[model samples]
Target: MSPWNWSDLHLRDPWWLTAWLVVGYLGLRALRRRPGAAVFYSEVSLLRLLPRTAAQRVGRLLPWLRVLALALVVLALSRPRAGQEEFRIRRQGIAILMCLDRSGSMETPMSLGDTQMTRLDAVRHAFRLFVTGGGPLGGRPDDLLGLVTFTGYAEARCPLTLDHHALLELLDGVQVARRPPGLGGPLRPASPSGLTAGGGGELPEASIPSDPYWAEERLTAIGDAIVAAVDRLKDAPAKSRVIILFSDGEQTAGVVTPAEAAQAAKNLGIRIYTIGIEPNQATLREIAEITGGRAFTAADPQALQDVYREIDQLEKNPTEGRLYTQYRELYGYALWPAVGLIVLELVLSSTRFRTLP
Candidate 1:
């Protein structure tokens, strides 16, 4: 906020200003026209020959002091307040579910802006910008944001919540779904060591790599992700329910098809925004059209941000405001000066400046 200029001060009762002018006129008139008592004498010039007393000289000016005090009293009656104009916002936020793909393909890097980042990295980074704010999508603090991640199957990572900071913490921990064989992660065992512990006592090298993985986790399940997101949002408190799905691969797993999921979302009045990275746009577009939503294709990170920017605009909820204006009472400003001026008048009127009969 900038400093308040003179224009920012508004008189709440401007009609009182007419009273101010009236009082000023009356006070000035009394000061100028009030006459002193004088005795008419044939030799009045001889009276002037007498030296003027200190009290008489000072006493003559005290009427003007009273007039000045009255003028100040008039000013204080007209309340002056500091006024500000702005949108006083109290957001009734939308409920949104972020459907993210963490399949192995996301590990592949793509060029974006001046840096090269993995698809998953780009998506996560862009989304963090969207959530915490500082990008095209200002932020979603008002919105309850949830997260759903998919690989071979979909999992709800977070429930719909207005606590975006906690959501971002969860987002930071997300990694590509499956670490391929020979690479060690939660799913796969560490690289096979030459030593073995089975045969009675002495260890022997393993003949075959332990089963590549317990389950195939690299496959994409687009339909399952969408369904999961919709399920979470179906009972959300807000009327503006939305699902934003970010994926790099087409459906390779899950019992439901993307088309069927889109129809279910449509029936529930949930809008789904689909972002596909270097994939068949036809499927995404079809899903979007069915759900009364839009499909965006992001070739690079910059393109991805633009797509989200567009979604930010489309998904915006009508913001309602409850205005809050803080007013510093300028009455004190006038009141103090008025008080000081009146004190001065009282002091002078009682001192050497005192009037005498």
Candidate 2:
């Protein structure tokens, strides 16, 4: 793999080496054609008085040094390369479907930095770091990534894809189920001014769960989110399949239960990592345990980011290649020496080898 290993040297364009040979021949021919130094000395006896210094002795080799430099430059033009050795490596990657719950509870704002922000907003920022790629997470470029969102019903926001930009756009749209200005169990959507609720507004009677016309289908459906996540990751080609569930509340709607979904996930060899974001019920832990996966809890923005980082560490793809190749460029070996020799030759010619016009 070393470019300096002469035995492993290879020229990409062997034809360029012809330039080196031609330069060498021309250098010798020029030496033969050049006449001996001539001076209009009145007598040869006067030359004996001049001392032959070390610089003058070294100047005699300047022409040879220039010729060698030119030859090396020609060698560099051929673009030499080093040996390429391939070795086998085993790489591992997992197909992950991020199942996020956008229930109303996510509207709970906590201190993200100097200011307060909603859990959903914080989760979105964490998602951006884990998916769009920032530090530590480096992103899952090799693995296929997908998004599944849920509140009362689960929606596949983006199918498993390598295109992170499109996925990020979908994540950006995921909003917490703000109580539609009615119920007190969960906060409603953020008002234009801020996420805080109206001026001590009383819960309207019609909006209660007991109300016959009330739509229960719009509550947190953790089970259904798991189901959708499983559906998204079932067909992935990666050896390892994972689902990261982010939820804020217990399941209120959805045909299948989280337990039932967990069984299905276990059968399909999919690991479900559950993340509870300011959760109301500890349901995520139960689901994670059932599915043979770990559960994480994030109470704030920084914690949510840290949870993502931990998951990133746990689920990232393993080294996948059985064979690999390494190469080094050797042009520097020739090019640098040529440059040094050229400089030395120029310095010698200007100093010790100076001639009168």
Q: Each prediction's TM-score against the native?
A: 0.64, 0.60
lDDT winner among the candidates? 1
lDDT of 2: 0.76
Instruction: Please provide the root mean square deviation of candidate 1 (C-alpha atoms, Å).
Output: 8.7
Q: Give all candidates' CA lDDT scores.
A: 0.78, 0.76
For candidate 2, what is the total of clashing residue pairs?
13
Report the lDDT tens digits of candidate 2 across residue range 104-182. Answer: 5677788977978888888888888987578777877677889988876788889988887888888888776543444
Query: For residue 65, what is the lDDT in candidate 1?
Result: 70
lDDT string, candidate 1, 283-336, tens digits = 788788999998899989888888878888898867787766766557777777
Q: What value does the lDDT take at residue 215 in candidate 1?
A: 37
